[model samples]
Target: FNDGRIQQLAPPEDLYERPENGFVAQFIGENNTLEGTVETIGEGNCTVRLGDGSVIDALPVNVSRAGERTLLSIRPERAEFNLDRLPEGTHTVKAEVLEFIYMGDIFRVRLRIAGNENFVIKCRNAVGQRRLRPGEVIDVGWLPQDCRALEAA
Candidate 1:
């Protein structure tokens, strides 16, 4: 992947949205991953407690048991910023704005969440979007369906 491409024979949407594994998720697009343990798993969703104690409600991509390690993969664009009030069954985590860059077409935000680095939010740079300031401590979230819960390893 350093200089070559990975070819995966997958449906276009699967490659972008529901990747088969971490390899595909990392290879096909920009994705944010978090390490955690499965807190609970029910009918259609799973709860994960991240490394820093942040809990995430995510779509259950694969069936897993409580206390088992898991991974949560979500795209930055799926991670909405301020103004999108955290809804029930959504993930809430504290993050500080490391840097916010306006790149014409979109707003690229660098964040430090729960001590994890390189966490980004590629949001729209439009009229209604929330403009963030560096050093701001804020709550960012995503809907359960927006994030996929996968095996940790």
Candidate 2:
């Protein structure tokens, strides 16, 4: 959508980073969504005005055709874990600890968001550290810059 070119091809790092549609974003696992409106477009990036009145600077995507409202998708790994308190200029979400399993090298924690979306985080298990129990409340945070705002199909 950025350059008005739609052909089946594998673009280089510069081109790939700025996909042509939401299809590329889904393939890249950018799932978390936010509502925003396009403000400006640049060579490799664009500025989006979110519904919450927060301006989001993201990689240039092909959502130019999308009118006033647009959905921004983000990946889970790009999110950060905030234990003490929520960080500023970041997206915060509450999740229930479903399971904490020891997988030898790391501890896999399964978290469910809003009783639907599920995400797993891997943490190094200390030799003598206490394990994280299930049914615990964990605070998760993700930087807006880390999120990918792609066009939805």
Candidate 3:
């Protein structure tokens, strides 16, 4: 709860998958938050222009129309760098690999994305997985529904 008030009452899955506001989104888990302005609102989705002038489509959770300030929230694991791991037609942004950590079951990667140096993506340790190196540039993306547009914090 923010400031001692109940922000939302829901199941764990609902809270993680469908947070209601910026506070809950940040409070519950590790989210990559980027400030942006709503550029367009469409059926079930909206486009946001980030501070670095990169446009990304996201699910409109707390935004209404164009020009509304929003905070784009995405989970690290939801962001994929290897295009082969994602479905076709996914939107992508360029990210530079800053650091790659070999976790036991997952590869924790730090990336510079959309002007955020601390942006991170977790790749599962699997057979035939490609190892990323520092200074390598790659395309990173997530499904539109995986990104949530909420009130700017």
Candidate 4:
């Protein structure tokens, strides 16, 4: 799934480590995806103004229009986890731990955000697994740069 001109330029490892575009990054395994608008563009980066008015700086991509809405995708692993601390941004959601399953080398954490959307976050088993129980409230965060502006659907 990670082989193409774009994928070749950024090998699978490098693509996930540092994606060249929002689509490439999310397709690799990013969570916390949202939609936004292109506020401005730079030489190597562009500012995506989210629906909530938060601006995210990300690699340049083809936005629909100057003011058209776009999708913002983020990987949960890239998010900072803290029960008491919350990151500053426009897209912040409180999710409840629905289940944590051990799938060999990775731990699959299933969460329900806003009681409507379900999100899955993959973490290495070396983390020793999370102690949070089902229904436990947890804080999820995503940085602006960590998010990307995608074409509108």
Q: Write the per-residue lDDT of candidate 4 for residues 1-153, one digit (tens) a residue.
A: 445444436666877765545556667655566566787776656777655454556555556456766666667675544523334453455667898777888776778654434566666666534655777877665555665566665
Best by lDDT: 3
CA lDDT of each prediction against the hidden true structure: 0.81, 0.58, 0.89, 0.61
Residue 18 lDDT (model 4)? 58
- TM-score winner among the candidates? 3
Candidate 4 lDDT at 50 equals 56
lDDT of 2 by residue, 1-153 (tens): 325655335655423344445555545433455567767766655667765465666654555633445556555445446433335655465667888888898776777754444566666666654566788876665554555556644
**Candidate no. 1 TM-score:** 0.87
Ranking of all predicted structures according to lDDT, beginning with the best and ending with the worst: 3, 1, 4, 2
Shift of residue 88 alpha carbon in model 2, Å: 3.9
My TM-score estimates for the predictions, one after another, are 0.87, 0.52, 0.95, 0.56
Name the weakest run of 10 consecutive residues (lDDT summed) in model 4: 82-91
How many clashes (backbone N, Cα, C below 3 Å) per candidate? 0, 0, 0, 4
lDDT for each residue of candidate 3 in 1-153, tens digit (9 for 90 to 100): 878899999998889888988888887888887788999998899999987687888999978889999988899999998788778977788889999999989999999987899988888999988999999999899999999999886
Of the two candidates 2 and 4, the one with more favorable TM-score, higher being better, is 4
